[model samples]
Target chain A: MINTEKIVEVQNLNFSYGQVNVLSDVNMSIHLGEFLAVIGPNGGGKSTLVKILLGILKPDSGKVRVFGKKPGTSKSVGYVPQDFSAGRGFPVTVREVAMMGRALAGKGTTKAEDKDVVDKILNDLTLIDSSEKRMDDLSGGQRQRALMARALAVEPEILILDEPASNLDMIGQTRIFDLLAQLNKNMTVVVVSHDLTIIPKYATSVACVSGNVHKHDEAEVTEDMIHQSYGGVEGCPVELVAHGHPHRVLKEHDH
Target chain B: MMELLSFGFMQNAIMASILASVACGIIGSLVVVNRIVFISGGIAHTAYGGIGLAFFLGISPLLGAGVFAVTAAVIMALITKDNKYRADTVIGAMWAFGMAIGIILLDLTPGYNVDLMSYLFGSILAVPKSDLVYMFILDGMIIAYILTWYRQIHAVSFDSEFASSMGVRSDLIYMSMLVMSALAVVLLIRVVGLILIISMLTIPPYMAERRSNSLKGMMIYATLFSLVFSLVGLVMSYFFNLTSGASIIFVSAICFFLSLIYDRVRTSK
Candidate 1:
């Protein structure tokens, strides 16, 4: 049961980094309660598109709206950036990091309600015991979960994550995806991932981004989409191991 | 030490040290966590231009330094906000350019009998009572700033992108931090001199960063460390007839290395 209310709308988006065109003529829309997975090869403007959607980067010529307003003008969106360890070596605890989510949402005061929200999110993430621990002391998986807790602490209507599980192991990746799947039942989720194998299991829809965006209406990754998004490289060795299915999406290339 | 306290000049130096520690503890923690030590050094050196302008205009050097430092900070913030990769090059050039401007301005001034060494290496013993008032006011402002906007500053420092996404005005916060760093540099110039100010702004915070679990804790511990080093270094300078700024920095450096060794030994165990 997908909600038809459009939560994010992008139109004729054109973006470039100092004359090197990244996204051109891209258009996409995300409805309420959508779980959109943005996928592409490196330098394919996957992260750039997410940034533009979050209003972190403005497009050259296009319109991006989140919740019917300009991106970043609304406080209903939470983001977990690709660089999860940006706070490493800094003297900030896990609870403090999560509390930062509430920093901009309301008057900057640590009310008891805000503390309760942070504690609940930390507990949900299984980080209640380490809530007082420094961010530098956490393991990679723990750090990822802590950052996710920060994003969730906002209690946002939409959550956006860029490469949330890039450095995680198989089990760690599965756990993160499971959490996202659980969270998607309530709020809209936008995830940028390079792992093609795991996305089909959780994503409600997929948008293949290269020089432009090709959105699929369902959670299915075809070989043609991968080939098209990867610039149609001849016999590109992109391994798409589909779970709960016996077929490989791409042909096995010999060494 | 009891006898020394009887002297008004010694009392003023101690007051200045305490005020300087407060500024360094708060602002230096931000500087270290943001990894903006080089930017801070650039701002401090650039303040020399202000000192020279003040001498030429027959005004207070600290006033001149404050104006020049804040202006330099704004310019640095603007240039570095978008051009992060080349920030060091820009800051380095500005650092030398400012010193050269100061030298030229001082040379052009008539009847320049000022002891430039005092400004370069610090004469904390000669600090007047008026400067202490300014230092006190600056400390109060820094404290008020932290109390009022601690959460926003924390968010911006930890992750500016996420902060911005959540409507924290991260760019504004970043610029304000740099401006605050410049003001802290101004507050420190009298106690440690321009060249040694960066050391005071970094060493204690760096040591505290390893021991603390929160930014506030880091600031408190850093302030304590800075206070101890200032007192110890002031006493050593009095007894050994040494330069006050250099002695203070020496004390901090010794403690920094010892902390490093202690961490290594404990970690191995």
Candidate 2:
């Protein structure tokens, strides 16, 4: 029987961009309060699937539900998109950027309460001191923190992240992982990342999708299983290769 | 002064400045925030082609400019959508193409002894009553649109994909922004002329950024600064016999420098 405790349910989800089919027959159920990490190679539909769940992109023929409602219709879902290397010049402050999520909450008439909610999120992110600093002036890690703070301002029951550790160095990546762990305690967290180093330790459940898809709960994750999914030969756990490339065992993952 | 106010042309200039200030201020804030200043500059200059087209077709220059500017804005938007690095290159090519086309068309219009300098530099003194009315209506639309759609606009400017994921229509929002920019560019050309229009569109918002937190507040401050500067410029132009557009830009530049100094002083403490 399907789990009644599920918060996110995707059934037979299929998606594509133009003629290229990215995701097909993807069915998954994420229980309430689960921390799920989605790891895949470059162009492996990781971002596409997360985008579908977040309502940024629609699946051709599938169902996606968040807390029993359509994905984007759920006010309780939060998202942090990959930092796409926007250059300097925009003069937005960190506080103002974070407030975007709160501003989008509900309809129009709740500005006062919205401010209070955003303030709380900033406090939780430890970003209160630098809130007034311009986003352009922030350090790389600080900018990422501000992005996280923006997502948290939604007070989401579920949080989605895409390549949260892409450009971060070791320290920055660790800090972001720690922050995600803290957030996972309060919400269902789903992360789409290619940083395989983080998967074994930080992830409670790991889902690998290339052409085919598979999932392993925290206890069920074995090194050989990771090698099989990622096609790392000679009995090493799957590791991120150079430049986000994947060497997989099965040609079926190449659809 | 009351005698000067009695002149219909003087009243038209005042109304035109007010209308132009509001449009330029709001749209300029978006341009500055989104870092599309150079593209907007290209759009303004490229609009000169429309003025030439209007002369050739015996239509109003404003109508030609409207069509020309919107077309340019869309082209620029599409070209720069996926390629941010090539923005300047594309804008430069379009800028030269627009000016060249305008000059060629203007030459082809026989017996057209046009006062081209007035179009290049604004002739606020010649602003028609009907144009003033158009400006007012457009300003009203800009105000209503900004207030009703502030959050969505802010989100798109900051993080488009995230905004899209939140169910905000980023594409619609982007198109609307371009349309507003087109309207602003057209109105600004009427009051400040194409040569000096970009300064008015960019300077006030640049000054306001030193003090404001949110885009909404930045826009209000920009409007106030633009209004004050344009008024001062108008009076100075009257007293000193200067070009209306250049005088206005001069005053805003002073404001920009002053705001910078004020920001530095506050931070030094």
Candidate 3:
């Protein structure tokens, strides 16, 4: 059974970029404590959907609700942006960037507890040694973890990452997924990724967004669903191959 | 240099330098970090239209420029904040238009004999005590705004999307910073003319960014750097009998190249 608590709900959501139809009638419901992987092809509105949920971009029509309120209302949703290098050259320290996550931690004021929280996150992410180092000075993997530490410092209920491991290699991607899986045990996690193989391994629920959104619990994902969701347009099934908790697999979907 | 400071005009120039340098320091770090240097240049140049309008109406030309600059800054900020590729074309068009208006208006002013070169290139030595008050007020405005809202500015500048997710009102903060920079550019005109304001706003901050670890550190260090550059430029102007604005920019440009060399060596190490 799905978790009873509804953390995110999207209804009839439509968004566009100057006449380009990005999202059309996208509807989905996310339950609490579920590691949701939002997968799709490139330029298929995955980032756009996440942006709407983050309240950075508004929809052309329809509603986006988080915790039974507007997406930006709660400030409980932590976000890891896609482009880690957006403003990296601005001379801000890693700790300073992480502290930005604390903006909504305590009613717009930093308490002693907030500092403790940041310190713990830095240490856990193995970023304590480089906390004072400039953001641009860190390696790509280190920067990603730093950003994750920043988001986790918010102590959010729902954490969303936009293609967290895009530029990373297979090993790097698995490392990130491992971290996300650990984080999901305590809080709801939503990751938008093009890595199809991660669905069965890490995600509790899958939301495939390609022009539209289709939500599938672990048991509902099938070869036809995977094909239509990802490989459908190319007249093939975009097969995902990975392993985690043992589950029965359809013989036909097996590659 | 001491003899130069003894004169009223030089004293006023020094005061103007302090006021403008501080404003540029605080505001310039933002301009460079936010990558809005080109937009600021656009605002500075567009302010020339205001100067022309003010002259046409027989009012204070500086006041006209301030109003025009702020307006241009806000508009340019809105248009180019997200779309930077279109910035040069938009700013270049406005730059040419502003100069055209200023030239035509100055031509129309009956018996107007003010040296147009002074406005094009700055004549900091000609600034009077009265203009210092405006500089101080504008300086106060920029400082108070940045200090009162440092967290918001810091968050928004580093990563606006994350800031917005944290309910920082990133767009509002972005607009306010751009508008504040517009006002700062207005005050800066007395030191460096509209033509040279971009370099004045960016050079010290660019050098400071390479050394400092935080935005606050960058702002403070950049201010000191600007102060030194202006002082050295002023002294060089007195000795070489060159245009003060051009000399100041020359000093800043030289420091900029040197900082690049230093950063290259350090990073290579």
Candidate 4:
């Protein structure tokens, strides 16, 4: 039973990076408890769409809203950026990073209840054992999980992640998607991923963004959609491996 | 050491070292973790413009540098925050531009032959009693700011984009951090001078980063390291007639290298 409550809405959004148009006349909406995978080619404005949704980047001309309010004005969104290791070598413990989520949610961790929330998040993410360890000491998978723990600690209604498993191994990627599947039971989950095969397994919907955005209400990744988003089969040689079946996701093309 | 402590000058120098250590220890950790050492260097060098302004206006040189440093920091923060790709080039230009202004202003000062070496290097032994009061206030302000906004600062330093998404006002926090760095530069200018300030601001925090698991712990450890380096460097300078600022930086550099070697050997084992 999907909730039809709209959590994110964008209307005629046009964005550019100094005249180089990234997103043009883009319109999309996300509902509550949605597991949306934003997929596109490199330099196709996937991350830009994520940033705009998170209010990190404002569209040049458009109306964007999250939780029925202007993006970034609401406190119900939790985001994990693409570069989770941006703070590598920073002197911060796993527990402290999770606690940052609490702080950001306008709830300082001084109270026992707040601390308990953070601890529970860390425990749920299987980061309890390494809670005292520095972020630099954690493996890539653990670091990804730790960042997830931080995002979850916000107790958000919507969770947005940009390339959460880009640096992980196959097993690690599976683990992260599985974790997202579990998390999607309660919150709206939006992810920007290049892993086309893994996305159909978990995402309830897909948004193929190039300079324009095409929203699919179903999880199925079609040949025409990929070809259109990637500027036809000649421009994109995408070999998608779904359920261990190695096959081209696009139409037949030259060798 | 006891005999030296009995002297007023020695007392002032020790006090100055402790206050300088406190500023560098707290602010320096943020500087190192954020990888903004170069921006800090820019602010320190830009402070010379303020020093020259002070001489020309017949005001306290420290005050001039403090005002100039904070102003430069705000400008740097604005430029770097928006135009990250070209930050280094802008900082380099500002660095040279600041020095040029200071040189011109000092040259135009009528009948005042300022000892350029004292400001370029440091004159810790010649620090006036009044400067100590300013240093104390600055340390207090830095501590209070950190305590008030620890979580925000931590978030911004770690992942600013994520922090911004979480309503942290990362740009504001980043600017504040830069302003604090500028103030820390003012605190250190008397102990290490403008040129040697970056080492004092970075080396101890870099060492502390490896040893601590939390930002607060790193700050404490860095502060302690800075205190030790300053005191030892001061004593060595007094006994050997060496430049105090250079001696302090040399001590920090040696320790930094030794820490590196120690980590490498331990890792190999």
Candidate ranking (TM-score, best to worst): 4, 1, 3, 2
State the lDDT at A169 in candidate 2. Answer: 88
Give candidate 2's error at residue A30 in angstroms. Answer: 3.9
Worst 10 residues of 2 chain B by lDDT: B78-87
Interface RMSD for every prediction, one decimal? Answer: 1.5, 2.6, 1.7, 1.4
- Model 3: colliding residue pairs: none
What C-alpha lDDT, on a 0 to 100 scale, does residue B81 get in candidate 3? 62
Instruction: Give the alpha carbon lDDT tens digit for every residue of B99-132 in model 2.
Output: 8898899999988988898788887877888788
lDDT tens digits, residue span B1-269, model 1: 79999989899999989999999999999999988899999999999999999999999999999998999999899888878468889899999988998899999999999989888888888899999998889899899998998988888888888877876777788889999999999899888899999999999999999999888999999999999999899999999999998899999999999999999999999
Most DockQ-accurate candidate = 4
The sequence of per-residue lDDT tens digits that candidate 4 reaches over residues A144-172 is: 88888888888889999999998998999
Which segments of model 2 are wrong by more than 4 Å?
Answer: A1-31, A42-45, A58-73, A82-95, A107-109, A128-142, A165-175, A194-197, A209-212, A218-228, A232-255, B1-8, B82-97, B108-110, B254-269
Stretches of candidate 4 off by over 4 Å are: A107-110, A219-247, A250-255
Tell me the tens digit of each residue's lDDT in model 2 across A1-255: 122488888899988777787887888888777678887666777788888888877789989997888867777888987672334656678888777787775633577877777778788778888989888778888888888888888778899998887878889889899989888878888998776666656667777776445666554444345545566322122333334433432222332
- What lDDT is reached at residue B70 by model 3? 84
TM-score for all predictions? 0.94, 0.82, 0.93, 0.94
- For candidate 3, lDDT tens digit of each residue in A21-138? 8888888889998888887656678888998998888899998998888877676888998654346678888888788788655433547777788888899888999999998888
Give per-residue CA lDDT, model 4, range B1-269, as digits (tens).
Answer: 78999999999999999999999899999999888899999999999999999999999999999999999999999999878569899999999988899998999899878888878888788788999999999999999999999988888888888887876788899999999999999999889999999999999999999999888999999999999999999999999999999988889999999999999999899
